[model samples]
Target: MKYLLLLLPVFLFAKFASNESCKSCHPIIYEEFQKARHSHASLFKDPIHKAAWLISPDYKKKKYTCAKCHTPTDEKLLASFDYKQTIMPDINSTAQKDGVACAYCHRIKSIENNETQNINIISKKEHVYFGNLKDTIKNPFHKTANNKRFQNGNVCIGCHSHYRNKYGTNICSTNEHNELDSANCVSCHMPKVAGTPSNMKKRKQHAYHGFAGIHNDITMLSRYISVEILRGIDRFFIAINNLSPHALTLHPMRVMQLQVSVIRDKNVTNFKSKNFVRILGVDNNMTTPWKAKEIVKNTSIKGNEKRVSTYMYKLKKGDIVNIRIGYYLLSKKVAKSLGLQNNKKVNRFILLKQKVFIIKPNSFAPLQQ
Candidate 1:
């Protein structure tokens, strides 16, 4: 059977290229890449990236340089952040338990921008592997190739398109207008579902290595976000459409809520919530990220942006409203000042999209369920 699946990773790890050697031939993309967050992009299983790199500022000079994209297959933690080593890389290492492994994103092969982020060249050719399949099936255990930046998402722009911080300003960014025709990031976070991405190939689907987002399949990224409600006559907007290409929160300790309510005749009334953040500071208050330097405030919501929240409430006739749109991978006051307020999956609340409508006679029907 394909030479016993190529002697099973050369008899288990004589090195077929670890991630437990692609779990014996990609066991359904290694069980959807172990419920991805890039398999808990490391610093020891990403508890909010190890509580923001243990109060970063390059954490006491042991400079783990965010392990070149969080432990990229730990070459002794990227050579202890390239020779500035003061002895650190072994949180039971296998690249700190395979953080962004699976052959370091199939041996990338390009991207080097730089100014403090964006640099994942990788491919020194050892046992090859890069893919956006155009009939990928030739693997005694490795060599694949194809790669048009994994079919145009620029392979996630070498670590999600941006980050600046050492006084160049812009502390976070998911492609803010360097737009090279944005929107693709692997067809919206690796979606293609169903199965068969190698048990040695039979194929009927594939592509979904569980990278969804907002930490885990978020209803398959709520189909890139949407939630309209218009109705005015005394005020009532709520639009919000961001069909995703970036910005809806790409970490600055994320937050995106939009709630809204109004039931009537059964009484519910709740409307005073409309958050969407992007704060960072040094003088206008709110700091962290090694004592920030800019972005003192930003309501965030861009990238095919639509954003409209107006709500002055008023829609009788059958009321019911209720439009939720959530997110928060850390804002409960930044998870109680980073103690992570009991980390229930990093401070709960994730929803993404919701709707109920029904206020007809001026138009608004969709509550039928």
Candidate 2:
């Protein structure tokens, strides 16, 4: 009878609980979250691993660690607190993507209740959000009953500061092994930097969701006019090479690659990945990536010429074409290194070029080259 009672409510939340509950009013935050590093697409897609099989009978205990560090919120989703595996299919599936989500934070009872207790106490806030998980926008009907916990740093400390019990235990003094840190994770990730908002009195905006790491700068830029495309009578071209050496430094551990394509009758995509260039290096290498379009046509650099590559295309009329430039960065260990994980500025690059056309529309049409 006792076991039956516990099973009853577990079934209820499973039926009704969702992350969309909080996304209702947080549309922009929700959309940016989909592309965040915590997303499964980035964590699970990684190449490094400790032991894939033979360690534990459960795959969740092994392969799912990536999700924990990348998207973990509650213990059920994580395998172990020390390594990345502390994750479950259900919780990891949602909580990880939310990244200090509304439900995860709103559920906090005290600053001390962050991630220490296994207990999930749900006290709603008046204007607060809930865990809907379905829609990206927050629902007014789902306002959390207001609580004092929301007024302070306790909200951010809960998940950011945790204990690594699977390995051993330690006094709160130690911050290693992913447990509680000497300074809370927010001390660095969301540093208390001052920013002057418009005409308002200089107010602190907590640290903001930017987190200020990896390709974060680039990610924020994508929300606006990051890419500009112009299709000509012959070849389709894009002028989105905004990475400038002078802009900011690029993260070392990050591998930035750009892909360019052109097709006949939108055939650009049908064909193979036309041409690509990968600019993977430290901040010092940032300035080297920029080169004028004229440099590519040069036969050879006799003396001290920094040679760069290009993706050139020649298209004709009535030909469908597609051009895509995608950018992705590494987090976790990568960000953890170079002190970037803590938050530092990296270098960036800027490029300029013209899409060349081999033939005129009236003169002749080229198949593809």
Candidate 3:
């Protein structure tokens, strides 16, 4: 039996193709993927990964732990470093530069379990590719196998779900899988388009390769949250509902802030701010990239959670109030410390819903101004 197994065709041992090879058959997907965050997963370009590598006290001695997700294809570079130094892979290599390349994802045979960081990918060097569709067709490039996990969203659980640090503490908690019933990652991230997956197949709805996420657009945020403002005699109430199945600001470094500002006579008066921050690190330092000790201040709304905060201010007639919301990938202080250019402004923040309530001696009503 062992001798017979060795007699298999040489294509069984064929090396996996590069992203370029995948482009020949999947040009549309390749183009969209280039715009995705996954394509820019290189350590040199990713600010978070660079900052972590620069600040980690154990980076020089231990293996960089980030490689398991960022650049899994650079196995040769990973082995060159000490087993402890597993996080940082060789960023100098071509395969590493591709980030999560096309071959890396399609070649995955199976995921052993759903543990976020402990995803066990069964890979083979052969030309066999796996997909959600079951209709096997003869293709010139490679063979295809059906994987139901791809359809159910379990395939993405390993990377998108909660993950623990070396200290056995939850560092990255993204429970998107548990939030929606029967909804898969592809539904939102890779929206379906009326087209075939490959040129060799008939026209059918296929998932887009954009892989939309936090970096995509504000429209995505609006889909998961709703905001309303209620006015009282001396205080204003801001109500936020987390319509998402997953926690708001799932990543440790990500933050969402709700701010209330008062304007009088076309000038700003009082400003109050509340932060929904995910705290991580050894000493509850929000700047720490990974190995979170605990959640220091998690004011963020959980799955299907609703929160209302009241701000009190002495309001006179003709007073205009502006309520705004901002979302950030990292605090300005942390971003400055890391010398990142993208952190100066609240780029991701958008005005969800704002209202101006005029206070009269006897009554208060919302005004257009």
- Give per-residue CA lDDT, model 3, range 1-369, as digits (tens): 777777553234224466777877677777878877777776776767777677775465655656557765566544555544443455566566777767777766665545445474756646777787656578788877766667676566556666766565666666533444344766666777776777776657777777766565445446556666566777766677777667777776666788777787888865657888767656656546455566666777787787888877666667766666657776666566566647544235644444455555544453322
Tell me the TM-score of each prediction against the true structure. 0.35, 0.35, 0.77
Quote the RMSD, in angstroms, for model 1: 16.4
Per-residue alpha-carbon lDDT of model 2 for 1-369, expressed as tens digits? 999998885554342234465355444444444544333222333222212211223453454543333443434444354556543445344453454444554455554343332223444343354222222333335443444444333344443333323323211212223233223333333444344211122333324445534434333333222334444453444444333211111222233333455545434444343222222223323211111111111121111222233334445554443434333343334444323444333223222222333334553322221
lDDT per model vs. reference: 0.76, 0.36, 0.65
Query: Which candidate comes out best when scored by lDDT?
Result: 1
Off by over 4 Å in 1: 1-56, 59-62, 74-77, 81-83, 86-99, 104-139, 142-192, 203-207, 214-219, 223-252, 259-273, 276-285, 289-314, 318-351, 354-356, 360-369
How many clashes (backbone atoms < 3 Å, residues ≥3 apart in a chain or on different chains) does model 3 have?
13
Runs in model 2 deviating more than 4 A are: 1-11, 15-17, 39-100, 111-139, 144-150, 162-207, 218-369
Q: Looking at candidate 3, what is the lDDT of residue 152?
A: 76
When summed lDDT is taken over every stretch of 10 residues in candidate 3, the lowest stretch is: 7-16
How many clashes show up in model 2? 53
Model 1 per-residue lDDT at 124:
75
Better of 1 and 2 by lDDT: 1
